[model samples]
Target: MTGDHYFSAQPSTAIQRRDVEFTVAGRDYELTAAGGVFSASRLDPGTAVLLRKADLPPAGAAGPFLDLGCGYGPIACVLAAVAPRATVYAVDVNARARELAAENAARVGAGDRVRVVAPDEVPDEVSFAQLWSNPPIRIGKDELHVMLQRWLPRLAPDGVAWLVVAKHLGGDSLQRWLGDEGWRVERHASQKGYRVFRVTR
Candidate 1:
């Protein structure tokens, strides 16, 4: 394996393409995958857990949903598919991941609904109605906390964030930290060694 982590802004390794298939909410998805992105060979287990446990937005739920740390756009695509009226922002620091996310969103015919962008490109004035993430935990706790601090506050007053973190990877501690930060957090579910957290301000 290369030294590159999925959170790397620009993965320097050579690209190797593959395909991944998974189902969410009884709908099957087959999307192209490749090297230099998160879980390039398969659906990430934490993401699967998040999708299975989190409450997906209603069909009529409106705009400005966020898929933080989006890798290959699985969460964003699924959200757009489920709530076509919503605008899903697929944000990532990785350039290649953004490219793949755009491609996958287009492949799923969510091109109009899913907007893949670099994290910095999202306008600060925009508040999200919903947020979803399988956060990049290997990036170190401090960095992870910084990322959460930056985005979690962008939730609209009634917005909710769905997050999944591995139990062994400070999931419980993160929950406490969110509480300390004044966000109401709930342990929505625990499955496959992952903690699904529902966060709100």
Candidate 2:
């Protein structure tokens, strides 16, 4: 057996593929997923809470949005579907995840707007109107902080970010850390052991 984490840059596991179905904003989505990606079989619970509780972009909102740590483009696809005028960057470190995300975007008719890419491939000039993530807390506190520090600053001056963390997984600490990092952090909602944070400049 291979010792591979979803965060692995190249996962050696056999691609056991499947489709994951979920509904958001009263619309349904069916996306393909595979082994070696985060939550490959289903929509992650924290992400589900984030989508359900946070303020989604309006249909008229035009954005260059970011779905950080995008597993298989669920958040990216949903954001693209809801905000048709937006361009979504679905970024992940895992190659397999990126491949599935691209395919899923096309399946959802969001191929033109959703750009599935690696973390480093994002253009330096791009700033996001909104950023969404169910961050990889298992990556450890220091690594997670580094990840946040890297991406959170890329938000446009008036931009907002929505994030969900499990309370059991240092969720409250993360809120405090974001505040300490000088962002205005609001506890947007709490549901089923997850803390949804609304962060802004």
Candidate 3:
């Protein structure tokens, strides 16, 4: 064992890959997971809620969607699968996660559509039609705020961001904070102790 967090850029833990299977929107996914990435064992409860509750991009949606803090490309793969014409960017700080994300993207037959990259590699000039995240809340509020500050403004004028945070993990407070920051925030849904927020500029 090592003192490694999922957010670590290079996790030192031994990689023991596992298979994760789940269904969303009548679609099934079989992706790889490994130690040292977020939700390595199963689809995270919060992410499950986020995907189930948030509005998925409609078919024919031409997107440059952002899957912020994408762990193993679940959101990215699903978005690519659903919005076949879109470009899905899966950003992660962890190298192993990025590797798995790319592999999973290929596995889902979306290798050509998904761009799995490090956070810094995303170009600044490009804006997103949608951003979906089960953000890294454990990274602390200050860091999380910095991340949001950096990315939220990249939303296109008519774009939307769907976020899921556990209520006990400052979900309500984050919504209030987003409102204070001048973005429109709506409580889209609440399920299993998770708060789904639909945000717009």
Candidate 4:
């Protein structure tokens, strides 16, 4: 196995691409996945739980949504599919992942609406109405905290962020940390050893 993690900005390993299929809210999705990206083989169970438990935005929900740490655009595609009016931003540090995300977005006929980009590429002035993520928890606590600190502030006053974390991977502690950091964190759901959090200011 390669030493590279999905979070690597420029994965130095060979790229082996494939399709990952899953259904959310009775809607089917088959997104492109590849080596060096998060959950390349299947829809991650945590992500499945997140999509299943967290309240999805209404069909008429406005634009400017975020899919933080988008792995080949599954979440972004689903968001765009469900909320046709929303402009979904799919952000990832991995270049290969970003490329596949863009392609997957196009395949889903959401190319015009979903913006696949690196984290730094997102405009500083833009705030999101909703943020969804299956965070990169294995990146280490310090880095994970920094990542949250950086993005959570970009939520609009009434915006909400949904996150799925493995229970054994400090999910409870992370919720506590977010609470200590002054955001209201609710355990929206727990299933298959994962904790889904609904966060808001």
- Residue range 78-165, candidate 1, lDDT tens digits: 9998997999999999999999999999998999889899988998899999989999988888999999999998999999999999
Local accuracy by lDDT, each model: 0.92, 0.95, 0.95, 0.94
Model 2 agreement with the true structure over 1-201: per-residue lDDT tens digits: 358899999999889999999999999999999999999989999999999999999999889999999988899999999999999999999999999999999999999999999999999999999999999999899999999999999999999999999999999999999999999999999999999999999
How close is every model to the real structure, measured as TM-score?
0.97, 0.98, 0.98, 0.97
lDDT of 3 by residue, 1-201 (tens): 359898999998899999999999999999999999999999999999999999999979989999999999899999999998999999999999999999999999999989999988998898999999999999999999999999999999999999999999999999999999999999999999999999999
Please write out the lDDT profile of model 4 over residues 117-175, one tens digit for every residue.
Answer: 99999999999999999999998999999999999999999999999999899999999
Cα displacement (angstroms), candidate 2, residue 38, comes to 0.6
RMSD of candidates 1 onward, in order: 1.2, 1.1, 1.2, 1.2
Better candidate by lDDT, 3 or 4: 3
